[model samples]
Target chain A: MIKLKEALVIAEAALKMARIRQLNPMSVAVLDARGCLVAFQMEDGSSLLREDIAKAKGLSALALGMGTRALVGRAKHHPAFFVGLSALSKGNMIPVPGGVLIRSPLDAAIVGAVGVSGDLPDHDEACAIAGIEATTYSWDAGADPS
Target chain B: MIKLKEALVIAEAALKMARIRQLNPMSVAVLDARGCLVAFQMEDGSSLLREDIAKAKGLSALALGMGTRALVGRAKHHPAFFVGLSALSKGNMIPVPGGVLIRSPLDAAIVGAVGVSGDLPDHDEACAIAGIEATTYSWDAGADPS
Candidate 1:
């Protein structure tokens, strides 16, 4: 289970890495297994939109059972369906990089997802990966979902 | 100026107050001034709906710049307009008794909002109020707006 405290630590770690790398101000969001917000942090200089984007990205990762980076190709192929999903989720389906699924390192069971925003897409994704690594949890990049 | 750590404290306090009162499982949400979620927590037994309700309540309070309880009377009077607002917000408007605006105690400037759900309306409101009181910020029950 992705405890709330663990989620908070992951998000904080992600933002810290962002700062350490001198990336633009960033926001991080963590969602529970049920796709509900657990904890979130917005750096003081981050734009307000970063908060929503991070949340949407995390929710999308949870709903699709894949990382946001992987969703990009699928979304591009099924643009209409993806747009419909955004409407259904009330604009929460953000199919972009920076969202990654978090799993228990021991068993590989999904725990939750973490999303980072407010920097270049790849940089945001890197921060999310770093955050997941900081925790005992492992990240599922959706490479081989067997 | 409400940081994520403070927001988490408020939400956790609201849930704790609910437990102390022996109320039903509850979910609490805190949103920053820009109307983005700062923290959220759902009790172990809370229904899934509680999460959505708590967030909608906080978002409504932020969008209207008043407590949800205060919005109830106005919503009753202008039912059509209020309904329209729900659509505009993609169903985030929840004019109920459990949402309260948070203001800086010293300056009373709007800082954020807290929302609680999954118990009796009055009980939820009480929990929200208690949580706000537990913090340094003041609760805006929509009195003395000036």
Candidate 2:
């Protein structure tokens, strides 16, 4: 199924892209519904802090149903409410970019998501999209990295 | 002009670039000095756990004038304090890669920050570098990513 292994593929692709573009380095990860690490990948020279980013963003993508970046705007309109969410999420709720929902394009059903950084917010989001886009496996049927 | 927006763009570019190159995906967050939302991004399928990685890493990066990733290394060697910090931050003070200070090139100052995830400690650091390079952004003069 579309489990942790799929997360690994996304990470591998992200890291490779980072190097080719010479955009510093990178760190990546995948998580399950409970926000636990399922699949993870980190480029050389990336820092340990990145691990947290990957986990947090990945979770955000799934929880928010929107990219982490989108949350920033919504949080602004409702400061108090956003803060409450931040607390409720145990500091895991981030309204930032670099995170997107992973779903079955065919049916548009939510499946998983990816989070990225090591670049700018937009850059992180872009990479995340790319990571999810190039997957040859089928989330509906569960598959391995292609 | 290239303040928060610049930072976000740089981070996103780095993430996408990294992913395309088969590197690691990353989680990145950008914030203003007052901890306002500047920009944010997360890769796709990043799992649902790392939702708040950006906020935690941003705090560390802004708090210190170095790199959050560095703190993770330190934490490994000194779990006692990290434990306390973790409790103090309530899981918001995540010390990991892809987290760094943002500053002005004209004058080294703690203006903003960027956090990343998805790779190993070293790799996260590299991705942070890519973000900085691609965007005319730099770490806070004395800010630490941790």
Interface root-mean-square deviation, candidate 2: 10.1
Fnat across every predicted model, in order: 0.42, 0.02
lDDT of each: 0.82, 0.62
Give the lowest summed-lDDT range of ten residues in model 1 chain B.
B137-146
Clashing pairs in 1: none
For residue A90, model 2's alpha carbon misses the true position, in angstroms, by: 1.2
Relative to the real complex, the DockQ score for model 2 comes to 0.04
Predicted candidate 2 versus true structure: per-residue lDDT over A1-146, tens digit per residue: 25766777777777777766777456666655555676777665453356666566677667766656666556556656666665666555655566666767677676676767576556766667677767853222111121
Q: Candidate 2: where is the Cα deviation over 4 Å? A: A136-146, B1-140, B143-146
What digit string (tens of lDDT, one per residue) describes model 2 on residues B38-72? 77777876756544776677766654345676666
Off by over 4 Å in 1: A72-93, A143-146, B73-81, B143-146
Residue range A50-106, candidate 1, lDDT tens digits: 878998888888888888888887788889999899999899888778989999878
> Among these predicted structures, which one has the highest DockQ?
1
Q: What DockQ class does candidate 2 belong to? A: incorrect
**Candidate with the greatest lDDT versus the true structure:** 1
